[model samples]
Target: MIASLSKISSYKSMNPIITLSPAILGALVVLQAGLNRKVASQWGLSAALLLNAVVLLIVALLIFALVLVKADWFSNTIRPSIDFKTFSIWFLLPGIIGCILVFGGPWAIAKWGAAQTFILLMSGQLLASLIWDLKVEGIAVSYVRLLGIGFTWIGVILACKWK
Candidate 1:
């Protein structure tokens, strides 16, 4: 674990682009949430999710085809190593959770507006991420981190204020 942490730190130091990727993803999530809300307003939640799913499927397929053509790595190394017997049913939770995220995001945006929804979503994500880091990864939870989480909750409350 220490080796992995050192490796990640080294890699981050070497490639700053990896650090900036999350910020880009955060902006994209906000954009996607707004677009999802608009689509939901026109087509309803289920139809919007379905449409998004279809679009994502098409894009993923295209990417996969390109990867297959450009590199023999996945086919030669990754695909051949599949062990179906070792796979658990819990592996499917990501898709189920994704569906929930897709459905709930637009609903929250419609009910609360984008700013409030984004704040609440970010708060929830921060809290969950902290807990996951501490409990699952056995990371030490510092006082500063706790204080940050408290501030995030306060922000969520302020954002949720009806007035």
Candidate 2:
């Protein structure tokens, strides 16, 4: 699996894209949060989130269209007869979580400001991700990872101004 992952550059010819994607994603999230907060202030939170979702859908559809044009894999591998009846209720959890983030993020930013909001959000992500790595991925936590987690919480504590 590791070998296959390391060969992603050979497969996609996008070594730089793969390398910089995370940083790009992080910057985009900050930009989105700020813009969404501004939109919420002008329009309202529900309207802002709705606009965000609509734009996201449009962009996603464009990407799917591009994939359909560029690759046979999507056309050939997508099953038209996917049974919604057979799907578990747990499948909806991710969408629910996404809605929570979409709504909660701007609200939090409005209340606490971006730095504190993102610091607390990062702490929550770190804690939840640690549990997921342990319980779901069956990863054995090392001392180094524990120390990193400790430092993250410490930073969070320092970053958040409690009244």
Per-prediction tally of clashes = 0, 0
What is the overall TM-score of model 1 with all chains considered together?
Answer: 0.80
The alpha-carbon deviation from the true structure for residue 112 of candidate 2, after best TM-score superposition, in angstroms, is 0.8
Q: Return the clash pairs for model 1, or none.
A: none
For candidate 2, lDDT tens digit of each residue in 26-144?
A: 77777788888999999999999899889988997887777766765565565243588899999889878888788898899899988888888888878888889999999777787
- Looking at candidate 2, the ten consecutive residues that score lowest on lDDT are 72-81
Name the candidate that leads on TM-score. Answer: 1
Residues forming the 10-long window of minimal summed lDDT in candidate 1: 73-82
Which stretches of candidate 1 lie above 4 Å from their native place?
A: 1-16, 72-81
Candidate 2 local Cα displacement, residue 101, angstroms: 0.8
Pairs of colliding residues, candidate 2: none
TM-score of each: 0.80, 0.78
lDDT of 1: 0.83
